[model samples]
Target: MERPTRAWVLHPDIRGDDRRRAPEPALEEATALAAALPGLAILGSEVVRLPRPHPGLLFGTGKIEELGAVFAAEEVELVLIDGPVTPVQQRNLEREWKLKILDRTGLILEIFSDRARTREGVLQVEMAALSYQRTRLVRAWTHLERQRGGLGFVGGPGETQIEADRRAIDEQLVRLRRQLAKVEKTRALHRAARAKVPFPIVALVGYTNAGKSTLFNRLTGAEVMAKDMLFATLDPTMRRVDLPTSDEVILSDTVGFVSDLPTELVAAFRATLEEVTAADLILHVRDVSHPETEGQAAEVRTILASLGVGPETPQIEVWNKIDRLDAEARAIWQARAARAEPHVAMLSAVSGDGLDAFLTQLSQALRGPESDETIHLAYPEGRALAWLHNEGVVRAERTGETGWDVDVRWTARQKARFDAL
Candidate 1:
């Protein structure tokens, strides 16, 4: 039998400043989840930019009743709100609308929970989930918590289930921390290995669905998943990219940032975000076609600052998705590119347009000068020679009978190490 599409998305805006106007962007995120998951169909979505809230419902009682009628007529099985709702509000809303309800936090958590493929990722998601669930324990299970325990309240210590839940959550948190620590240790070792062959790490970061993963794959020829959805790529992915100047570097694709990211998620995903903290360069990919492009860029910068990425960190703003822009806007951005600050690259990652200019600029930034140096090495200095081979742009290598003659053009760090040797 065929079932009706029965999911409705809601975005609530608590009116304040211009920033609190419309939450269509958040509703769009919820719509992406509906697209990914099965059995739930999104019937429609609405934004309620209200001046005040109601106690029983987030909206006024009259509006709530109005939405209730709409839900009934539309046969909505689920109501996905694009904002965090309290446990009591969720309970009341579900009863009033006669449907399941999920908030922005819950939705984001579910996305993370689904996208977590690795053990560490799964553990982190579970830990975050448990932390969130501990507060909303009422939603999952409706039970009396005031039963007398023999040990503490009414039942014996062994029979106290609430204590067991608390204990279990603590134990899980400990285990997750230990596992994440191990993962961090392993990542540190890997980072050290990369340092030995030091390639500048460039990370692409932007708002969700900002085409970061697409740009990443376009640059590195990698097949990492790229979709037009919120939080498409959860884990960090790194790949080697050979620039236009024949300089090879490591380009990392990081998880996209969003406005009003759940605080729990920010802490939970710190492990994955360490890659961004270690980046030598950041490509702030902006969806220039998005109506909220400037606002999205502000959010990305805000998150970057909160992550302690200092002002001195070199960044190249890549205004992506120019293909989606109209001709006038594209031309205007192009004209303004000449005066664009320190580093701004306007290009369409999908079309491979203007990529050469961006790559040329990046290569020049990576390799400051092309002053070739004729370097001499003592006999049997294979280790130093190998280091040069890996880290430097070796123009020519000649193995003489007495020693080795190498003409290398590399970065300052590589030259310093070679000079030390």
Candidate 2:
């Protein structure tokens, strides 16, 4: 097998920026991002402090030369910058260092390029990639281990970079959008069909590698990609989870959120998150053991709000990955979680701890108004009676002269569906 391309990562911590994140944690996350790509080996990473970005080279001349010398001495072939790099900066940095350089947006696009599987996913990724390259078409993007020309950053052998001309890129975008529209229409139909079902949708969303997929797999017994890798699962996967309360919900494991997600990819992937908007409840999972967990959770909330999720959708905080925490930290989190009660549940998805309470809380949160009613149904309405029994809501029943008197306790949603029937 071909050796993984050696790479170095840098997170520029600009001074006097009120919104600046903790640089070390940011560098750690950026390193993880670099590690997520299959063909990249993160040799080292650093937080590069800067007074301000230079117009052409991003970093000052002295710093640029210093970094170039460092990369050369370490045999680094690629320098992955953790923040935005202007087209000119990318070009200049590459020219000076004699190494390929990828900004955060380009790196993410490459990861998505590697992970996207479904036809819709592939098309959306292609369109987003084209839009990204449209701005910097003069330079050849460093394709990875494939040894192909052009934007082969993540594709396999025989895959070639495409569409150099502005008109050509626009035409490709139009084609991809058209194909995606068909896929989306089919998805809408499937969603409409799912809506006819009485189950509630509970979407699992959190920062990438926050154990969303692990929790999902534990709850639903389906193996989704639960590796300790960023963006482990790109497409959303759903499974019917039968809660201990005897209630069932369609649990959706969506693409994970991340700090500073690229704008192009966010727009491309927005439609995939429609399941979230239509959900009855959102499970905001978190990696409680991580040092930057609070900031990560805040970022997830910000993204959710930006996606137009409002107060109408109820959300529960799932503090996951307690197995990775020390005893003292775990005790503190447990107590903190107790005070938050149903709204927050601290658990370890891998160890199956605290999941039961979390599920019970989930059932309560999703429970609509309960109605107690005695309904009269004729013998011909046996199917409706069976449905009530199947739902485990039947309390008592008595045969009458022409039909049956049924005592059932169910939620408002269940009542409505039965009424429609």
- Which candidate has the top score in lDDT? 2
Worst 10-residue lDDT window for candidate 1 reads 146-155
Model 1 scores a C-alpha lDDT of 0.77
What tens-digit string does per-residue lDDT give for candidate 2 at 192-223?
99988878999999999999999999999998
Cα lDDT of candidate 2 equals 0.86
Quote the lDDT for 384 in model 1: 85
lDDT of 1 by residue, 238-346 (tens): 9999886667789988888887787878888887887888887888999999888888899999999988889777788999999998989998888877788448999
Error of 1 at 24 (Å): 3.8
| Segments of candidate 2 deviating more than 4 angstroms | 137-164, 395-399
**Candidate 1: misplaced stretches above 4 Å?**
1-5, 17-21, 36-39, 137-164, 368-410, 416-421
Backbone clash count, each prediction separately: 8, 0
Residue 228 in model 2: shift from native, Å?
A: 0.8
Model 1 earns a TM-score of 0.84
